[model samples]
Target: MPHPSCARRWAMPKKAKQADLKKLAICVGLGAAIWAIPAPAGVGLPAWRLLGIFLGTIAGIITQPLPLGAVAMMGLGAAQLTGILTFQAAFSAFANEIPWLIAIAFWLSGGFIRSGLGARIAYSIVSVFGKTTLGLTYSLTLAEALLAPAIPSVAARAGGLFLPLAKALCLACGSDPANGTEGKMGSYLMMTCFLSTTISSAMFITAMAANPLAVNLAAETLGYTISWGTWALSALAPGLVCLLLTPALMYVLYPPQVKDTPDAPAKAKEELKRLGPMSRDEKITAFALGLTVCLWIGGQSLGINAVAAALAGLSILLVTNVVTWEQCLSDNQAWDTLTWFAALIAMAAYLNKYGFISWFSDKVVGMVGGLGLSWQAAFGVVTALYFYSHYFFASGAAHIGAMYTAFVSVSIACGTPGIVAALALGQLSNVMGCLTTYGIGSAPPYYGTGYVPQAKWYQFGFIFSVIYLVVWVGVGSAWWKVLGLY
Candidate 1:
């Protein structure tokens, strides 16, 4: 007979399989229920059917009955097999530039980790400003902000890069979660770093994978084109303010027992000394990153597409062997993102193409118009609803794919300025991740550290969600006014 522990391990997979099957049943049931509804007067049957598939796919993504890519493939197949879309129409978005841009950027982002540049930068900042607990948290925040544009994956940036660093700092300070000493410094740092990732994600177009999806949706839905420079400039002031305030705010809300960490700087320096001089790969990665960023910011004026710029950057990395071709092929995240992103984009575009979005916008406008509120107030209501709805979403990409275009459409239909509506909703697509531990990609690792209890995590998440909205909407609007974005 097997040992008890071995038997328990064998039983675990069966239990997980049952759970997944239940979730999958929910997704299929939801889709079937929606499909049973008659198509609205102005919408085609195909459009309504695609909506069912799209929504079911979103539910699958959130609940994760299968891998994200598998969920997406199933949704796409459902649409095609049900005669809701042709094979060509189902896969056409794969040809779009947005998905390719994100995929290529993901490959480029890997160089930061592979070259040890990401760690080097984090340690260097810690060595400079890590004398106190607050300062140490700020250093991590700064590192995240600096790295966000280059590293598109928040999981990689936060979990792979900063999570380990934060844990190390905590260990160095004798604050192990295992020892009930997480309050010494671990909890505060973990919360701050996790929140900071969301803020930095809002700052740049390339900072998060879903950001480009939002950009694409805005262009398709609102006919508003937000360039890389526009996104960066619009977010610069508000993003910085959020980053600056987050560490301090967390320090106040979740004070560390260890207020002074005098040894942190020494530890960081020792880490730096161990890393020694920058390797050739690091220099190449740095050069490629700098060039890509400059091009992204100003390449439009030079008549270069942002996707072209990213492709160029990835080419440089491959040529220099900063990241090998084999490594790029092995980048499961990039390929997975490409697959799901393309499918969702195709589905969303077809929704608009078939006139469902316009029909839905009309229905929304009629309801909101009945309230006799001013356009500004209507938009505020819409924006608030959009931001808070993130609580129901696990992946930022799923949230963006499912709701961004519709919300932007409703906002514009309510007479909000198109650019203002698009940018506001776009920025919130990222910042909304601050509302829950499972709100986005980077949340799990930080929360899994056991530093902050689930209750405290949710509590701080709510507090910061409000704080983020005020900063991004209030301060961000003022900055946008100066830039004439409105």
Candidate 2:
């Protein structure tokens, strides 16, 4: 080790400069200072500080200067307490549909995971395509993608299924969990699986409970007609493509390469052998899920809505003992996540109700209208609106609840196509996940697991956000136009 002075002179910029520590500290310090204020008014230095905090946060999120979730919650609490927003308004986020959907679905997914049912399902997927690493990765992704459009819970698919199986595979491959490639792979794959599931959750109406409301609002407010299959079809390309690439991307992101081990230990082999068959719970859960899909699609085609379809499946499960109320209630992360989601949705809706969003949006639109670049000006509004969304919402549904109608209505007034707006809004729901780890539509269970460090998670978020923004604005624009959505 070098002397303190010499080290200070030579050490940091190369190896120690991995993160913008000073910036993070400044933001955190200032954010905490604002948080300490009794009144969060936007009028004086406090107001200016609050504004700086807000702009700084957005800038940081765009630049990934820190953790998004921590920052979001801090902002939430501060804005409310400081009088910038009402407590009722701040707390109102808990009542939102998106949060409710996200939280409740986790319980639904948890029951499946806790009951050993999720494993049997994974084993089946692996049985079909677990020979090669790529095959296994794709197989897991396919299971997620296929179910993503219908299942409200992603944790069950990622944490419950993928993580466990990946771990088992690592163990089987002689990879030590104590440290190194195996552990990294497990962590990385788990993150990938979680992120993919969150993004994919935007693919269908039933994929998340908030979706129906989003669709309904768009329909009611903007006369947009978003059929279930049509919505899925619109999102499947981008969402699925993302899911397919995620495993490989994460593999690189984490960079873990350990070959499979020879075989299982004799004792472990015996245990595996004795693991003889899928548990009864597994059998029923699998059957129930399959039936749920059929009924969900067929029932909806028969004119049933996603909620009705979900309730129908849920009811049937409760009646059949597939998932009991006790089990559902016991799954803390599941329901908590949903409640959190609901709060977000409610808050967004409340913002609109209070004229907060409309006032802000009107001013923004007014400012852009003067530029006179018509389409480009319009794009600026869309992009700004999308960025603002993460500040308030934690998921796609929440974003939809907050701004779907407002954005669409304003777009139409500006001569943007309704179809274009719908697709843009839908895709924005998935894309926002990149802004922050917590901003992920389906992230609670993943985040709650304590694997992805809050800061690194935010880092991943910003990087992914750039990818999403470019993809949607640059590539998606042309695709939507060519597809006649414009």
Candidate 3:
């Protein structure tokens, strides 16, 4: 590893660094040129100016012209320099509870990873369920669901735990990627690993970094507040069905060549023995996580916000030394997410404040109205299109930033109930990740194993995306209806 002092200098080859700078300059130059065009009829100059910065920021994110946060910071700075937003307004993004909740959850999960609690839990489940090829698939899925709530970073949970275990399981079964034997069982498990995490991410507001961002956006758009309990309760029925059926569906769709793995349980047990007993730090992390869940679920009645519960839990971990201060600070992903999320949140807020979102919504609603479809039909078409549009996006949060508000606004204007519209759109923001190998946080790690080729991954992605949408849309719609969300 390079020294800390020179880490950024040596982070990439010089050629790649220059290429990224070129991409950044092109995005900014094009965005500024676009902003120079005169606004039509009623759109104000500030809204148009802010829109320019927003477009440029999104370009940087998609092209990865810089680290995501750095790109976002440049947008924030641009907004201030152009006088589109005051200093207080731009910095106000950090004051929002949504980003803080996400950041703190990341810190709390660091304790689980650092203390080895998450790995212990995964191995424990594996020992029970690894007796059969089918059982081992379910074991990995269940392990991810258990960890998703506390661990906001799905990439860490899936990559850190599922990736290594999956490789081991596949190799143990003689399904080596290098030998072209991934068709045996490796492909099935790897596909299930990613699909399961996507479902779990939709099931809880704290399950992924983008979920809380969805909640905040829903609030900004429709005055809806999605708490941890509300998000879980809404997703409980369909989410459980999707989780239960995904492994079986993949088993049939992508059948494993090696089926009779009767010795797998013994292998898992042996691995567990090697890990030994859970350490004190592991115990403490588990306890803190459990407590945090309880507080997140119940604290609303006691006048506590979920953000506070997360902070309180993180404090316990810090004080108990379950995770060191340096470990928490060194969580670069969490901090990076915080910066970009804040910047996006600020832009979203200013867009609403400047009437850009509302103005754009009215114009879109008028065109949809011109189609002469009933409100129900219009919304159904829009929602389907929005969910499948993930094929064009590589990040869930960025997709949310670009399309969520306008879609929700259109849905509401088309006479869809606010609560129903908000929850469905919010949930789909995560479920849509099933459409691509690079669509969400956990996608790359699972895809990087090379067990599933690009063509096969996309094929499976389309097939599974349909299954997930049916469960989430059909079954989920019924569940929400029963809850009177509509």
Steric clashes per prediction = 0, 14, 0
User: What's the TM-score of each model vs. the native?
Assistant: 0.66, 0.66, 0.66
Q: Could you tell me how far off, in angstroms, the CA of residue 410 lies in candidate 2 after the best superposition?
A: 4.1
Q: How should the candidates be ordered by lDDT, best one leading?
A: 1, 3, 2
RMSD of each: 8.0, 10.0, 7.5
Model 2, residue 188: distance off in Å is: 1.8
Instruction: Answer with 1 or 2, whichever has the higher lDDT.
Output: 1
lDDT by residue for model 2 (219-324), tens: 8866656888777666655665666667777666654453232232343344445556777665665565555456544665586643454455456567777667
Q: Which stretches of candidate 3 lie over 4 Å from their true place?
A: 1-19, 131-264, 374-376, 384-486
Q: Can you tell me which runs of candidate 1 are displaced by over 4 Å?
A: 1-19, 131-241, 245-261, 374-379, 385-467, 470-486
Highest-lDDT candidate? 1
- Model 2 gets an lDDT of 0.55
For 1-486, candidate 3 gives per-residue lDDT tens digits of 101211111122222233387889988986797699987667888988887888788677657678767888998999899899898988887986656665665666556555666555645555677667898888778878987886665665565445655655565456766567888888998998888989888888878778788889889987657778888999899889989999998999888887766776686677667768877887887788777767665676788766777777788898997766776666565677778767776776677677665676556666775776887788777788778766545467767776787888888877888777778888878878777655776776566556877667778888987888788778988898899887
RMSD of 3: 7.5
